[model samples]
Target chain A: TQLLEQSPQFLSIQEGENLTVYCNSSSVFSSLQWYRQEPGEGPVLLVTVVTGGEVKKLKRLTFQFGDARKDSSLHITAAQTGDTGLYLCAGAKNTDKLIFGTGTRLQVFP
Target chain B: DAGITQSPRHKVTETGTPVTLRCHQTENHRYMYWYRQDPGHGLRLIHYSYGVKDTDKGEVSDGYSVSRSKTEDFLLTLESATSSQTSVYFCAISDMGQGKAYGYTFGSGTRLTVV
Candidate 1:
């Protein structure tokens, strides 16, 4: 079975600080997706990267797919309280299943 | 935020008791998935349905069973509740064809505790 691992499982920073979360795996995937989940709620999709070395930006968040499709990263610039949540990365092959990373919980204090 | 909804937002059951969780969606999406979320484990798929009455097991289907008799409803059943099964369950939907790049829309989730 394929597995995805995320680094810095928990993070806390002051508002305006920058932070980066990493997701890695030994198996290559066709695409990778990022999701943010608030307390007591299901996760919400943040972005999807399909091609190797592809980068997508959504407001203050930047997501990048690895050149080998075996890893990904999410970076937050000038983080705010709204940016605090659990961030998850999922790797998908050609099938319907997606392997999700452990997750990174971020807390941005104002 | 999709039209997906899960019933019994929270439930408590005893060991050896049977329990079922319901997931309902109004988007008419062709695919629905059931997943369990734990503290260290982000989300693990337990089962999924591609269409009405078409279902398949996922990575963590050991003690779980699923039935999809209709397009909008997917049911997950645990024959006998176990303490290890206590976790938050989420239902998700996607409309993309196979091999397509798309994200899933997830329901709020159900928190179950087995004692």
Candidate 2:
């Protein structure tokens, strides 16, 4: 079985602070996707990185896939209250199945 | 998400009782998956179906069964509810295979509790 391990399981920061969440695994993946989920709702797709060492930016969020395709990271710039949520990283191999990371719970306070 | 829906937003039942959860989709996506989310465990895939009457177990398929008799509905049943089974269940739909670059659209989720 493949497993994705995420770091800093819980994060609490003030508004305007920058934070980085990391997702690591010993197994390599063909593609990796990032998602952010608010309370009482399912996670929403943020971005998908298919290439090693590739970086994609979406507004204030930036996602990067490691050179080995075995890790990924999500960086938030000037996080706001609305950016507070559970961030999840999902990796897929050659099949249709997706293995999701443990998750990073972020909280931004005023 | 928009096209996917999960039934019984919240349910609480006694242990050893059978419990079933439903997932309905209108997008006509060929792939459907069931997952359970728990603190420190993120979302764990329970089962998935590639097409009607076709299904496969996921990483945490033990003690759970799934059936996909129709194109639009997928059902997950717990043979006998156990306290450890209490968790938020999510259903997701995707039109692409290998999940590729496009991620899945997930339902609000079904909160199940076993006492």
Candidate 3:
């Protein structure tokens, strides 16, 4: 079983559409990070949330860390073709190592 | 994958043969990690290092072994390759010095196929 479970394993949306992807876990984390990965490339760091109940916005994307630090959500507005990729969430607990979620594959059609 | 480098971007090996993947970093990060990415499984940790000569197993560390002899190099080896072990491997580096805010920088990844 994956420590971090991501919802909507596969997502297909049209350009300009909006959607939210969720990462959930029963265990709390000290730090959580979001990443976007393109085909034939490694994952690129998107954002990191350490404080509980913290929210951050990156251009058209919004990320929120759950109050319990066991969940997180990423919402993208006005999705574009460039936003298409595999999204992964990783959580760090007491150690320096990170546990990654199952990942969500997003396809935004223009 | 700017600061980190993974060698042999692609490789094909026969079952039962031993294979080794290399991860070299110039950033001097204190931590190095190895992960395998598979469909439906995302990326699963194979092993990781906290410092030179210090390593530990990860979620899916079976059939794999790691060694970190220096701060900039972490190596992952598959003792006996199997078709089930065929997957894309990624190397990641991390350092915890930015006021507790932490994130990982990953290598471009190595595509390994076991025939």
Candidate 4:
């Protein structure tokens, strides 16, 4: 089984600060996805990077997939209170099932 | 936002009781999945269905069973509810080959607690 490990299990930052979360794995994946989950709600997909060395941006969020397809990173610029939530990264091989990483909980305060 | 709905957003039951969770999709996607989210374990797949009457186990399928009788509905059942099964459950749907390989849309999620 492919295991995805996320760094900084918890992060607390003040508003306007920049932070980066990392997701690493030894096994290669066909696709990689990032999601944000809030309290009492299921995770919402932020982006899906299919190719190696791919980069996608959504507003203040930037996602980058490693060239090896074995790692990914999420960078949030000027994080606000709205960015506080649990961030998760999932890797998919040939199968439909996603191998989820140990999530990173972010707390952004004003 | 994935045309998916999970019934009984929150439920509390006693041990050894039977419980069923329903996931309905309006998009008529061919792939459905059930997953549980815990504090430390993140999200773990319990079961998934590729088509009607076709189901398969996931990483944590023990004590849980799933059924898909039609293209739009999937059911998950727990024969005997256990405290360990208490967690937030999520339902997701994908569009066969394209959706599965690209990404998945998740439901609002259901919170279950077994005492």
Candidate 5:
């Protein structure tokens, strides 16, 4: 099975700070997706990058996929308390299954 | 936000008992997935169905079984609950495609605890 590893299993930062989370895998993927999950809720899709070297932005959040399609990164600028949650990255191969990363727990204090 | 709803948002059951989680979608999507979420492990797919009565196993499908008798409903059943099965279960639905473009919609999730 393809495994995706996320860096900094847990992160704690003060408000108005900037943080970046990384997801890496040895296997090439057809696509990659980033999700943010809050407590007692399922993950919500943040962005989906299909092409290699693709970049997408949502408000203060930015996402980028590696040129090799095996890695991705999420950067949050001017973080706030609302940004605290578990962030996950999932890699999709040619098959229907999606291999999810270990996840990064972000805690932004006010 | 795709009209996905999971029944029994929270459940606590004894060991060696049967438990079933229901996922209902009003979008009539052709693909449905069941996943378990735990700390450190993230979310692991248990089963998925591409169409009615068509199912496939995922990476962690050993003790989990799924059934899809209709286009809008999927069920995940545990024959005998175990402590290890205690986790939050999520249901996701996507349109008939490669699941890259349309993106999947997830339910609120059901938290199951086996003691």
Candidate 6:
């Protein structure tokens, strides 16, 4: 079984601060996806990175896939209160099923 | 937001009882998936359906069975509820086939508790 581990499982920061969460794994993946889930709702896709060393930006969020496809990272610029949520990283091999990382819970306070 | 919907937003059942969770989609996507989320565990796939009447087990398929009778509906059944099975369930749909370049759109999710 493939597994993805996320660092700094819990993060608390003030608004305007910058934070980065890392997702690492020993197994390589064909594609990786980042999702942010708010309380009482399912996860929403933030971005998908397919190429090694590829980076994609979504507004204030930036996602990068590692050069080996075995890791990924999500960086938030000028974090806001609204950015408080659970961030998940999922990696997929050659199949449709995704293996998800434990998760990172971020809280941006005013 | 994907047009995916999960019925019984919350449910509570006793041990040894059978329970079924339903996932309905309006986008007519060819793929549907069932996953469970826990505090430390992000989301674990339980089962998925590729097409009508076609389904397969996922990483955490034990004690869970899925049936896809129609393209829009996927049913997950727990033969006997166990306390360990309590978790938040989510339904997702993807138009692109599995491992495609696209991501999945998830439903609001259903919270199930077994006592």
Q: What's the TM-score of every candidate structure?
A: 0.96, 0.97, 0.96, 0.96, 0.96, 0.96
Q: What local lDDT does model 1 show for residue B32?
A: 93
lDDT of 6 at B73: 96
Candidate 5 structure, TM-score to reference:
0.96
Per-residue lDDT over A71-104 for candidate 6, one digit per residue giving the tens place of the 0 to 100 score: 9999999999999999999888888677888999
Prediction 3 global C-alpha lDDT: 0.92
Sorted on DockQ, best first, the list reads 2, 6, 1, 5, 4, 3
- Model 6: per-residue Cα lDDT over B3-114, one tens digit each: 9999999999999999999999999999999999988767889999999999999889999999999999999999999999999999999887655477889999999999
- Per-residue lDDT tens digits for candidate 1, residues A68-103, read 999999999999999999999988888877778899
**Residue B34 in model 5: lDDT:** 96
| Candidate 5, superposed: residue stretches over 4 Å from native | none
Runs in model 1 deviating more than 4 A are B97-99
**Alpha carbon deviation, residue A79, candidate 2 (Å):** 0.7
Global lDDT scores for all candidate models: 0.92, 0.94, 0.92, 0.91, 0.91, 0.92
The best candidate by lDDT is 2
Q: Report the lDDT of model 3 for residue B5.
A: 92
**lDDT: which is higher, 1 or 3?**
3
Clashes of each: 0, 0, 0, 0, 0, 0
Local accuracy of candidate 5 as per-residue lDDT tens digits, B1-115: 6589998899999999999999999998999999998877788899999999999998899888999999999999999999999999999988755665556789999999999
In the range B4-97, model 3's lDDT, one tens digit per residue, is: 9999899999999999999999998898899999998889889988899988888899999999988988999999999999999999998863
TM-score of chain B for predicted candidate 3: 0.95
Chain B alone, TM-score, model 6 = 0.96
Q: List the residue pairs that clash in candidate 2.
A: none
